[model samples]
Target: MSSAYKTSAVENTSKYGPFTKMVDVYGLKILGLGNVGGQPQVSTEFLNKTAETFKLLLDPNAAGINKKSREKALKGLTSYNVIQRVGVKAHITHTRQALIAAKYRAGTKSMTSIDQEQTSSGICDLMGGPTLLLEQAQITENLEHALHTITQFALPAAFPQEMNISSKNGKASGISGDLYKALREAIANGVYDDSDYSRQR
Candidate 1:
């Protein structure tokens, strides 16, 4: 019955097509007949404006380039895997916001001053916060530890085979042959540094 609830219901219906019935069992007219089963309409001019807005957001300095070229570049960038990663990060941020809201409502945790300040500043959404930072740092540390573990296991298994190949006619074999040849050439040319050898050992 609240304005907020009505607004949310309308928005939800707009996203998906409208429902079959306009009124619920309570005999209250929720949606008009015209709106029922109707898809949201988007204008071509509106789409063009949106594309221009995003182009400016992505590359503000692209003033010299024409609109079509800028749009083409923007399309290519959006098609890349980086856009998928951005979508994933956005989803995670939204999920965190929902969890924080639930915790605040349940009185389980106090909302931070930063969150209150952000809300007061007319920013209703809390995307990146301390939680996001902690998550990113934890992921980075885990990745570094995994890489270290993998290298530790791989090098001992690979070193003896490489040594055997290098000792035979000074020719390296297998997938690492090119890398081995480059290293030997660098050492022969006195370009290979041994300063880190002691540290590595």
Candidate 2:
């Protein structure tokens, strides 16, 4: 393996945990034990480091304030939903990487790259040239499409109920000006573009 590949493999494994779904210890040993006659050997420290890295990678708060922007900028989003969506994206990215590695290992492809690079337009692309762009684009497009379904179908179906509201006119309604204010503040400060007050409305 080239130094780049080795470095990325170690980093990714450290971040994502052994890629267990694709990597077979026995098969790796058969390939080479390095010094233990196909028995495979790894240090405990390395394993621990990998665990820590994986923890960081898989954390729902991995992106810190950045992920919050998505929720706050969009209409009718809650903090709870933001964290849930972050988890979903992380899992999807993990699954995509695993599939890539497994396909590469199975010889379905001659070789593949590992690292993701940020483009000038601020989007992410993988190392395999144009194909990586397509893959990432497809993931983004699919997720965006799914969001429409969630809002239109799943959310209404799941939360179909009349929530009571106290009105100043001594009547119960399903609206709250306070909720709108909270949402407005969240959009102004929590989102990326605070200047877009129109979006907050």
User: Best TM-score goes to which candidate?
Assistant: 2
Report the poorest 10 consecutive residues by lDDT, candidate 2.
Answer: 26-35
Stretches off by above 4 angstroms in model 1 are 1-55, 58-62, 66-69, 77-117, 122-201
Could you tally the backbone clashes for each prediction?
0, 0
TM-score to true structure, per model? 0.18, 0.23
Model 1 Cα RMSD, Å?
A: 21.0
The alpha-carbon RMSD values of the candidates against the true structure, listed in the order shown, are: 21.0, 17.7
The pairs that clash in candidate 2 are none
Task: Please write out the lDDT profile of model 2 over residues 102-126, one tens digit for every residue.
Answer: 4323222111122221122434444
Model 1 lDDT, residue 146, Cα: 28
Clashes of 2: 0
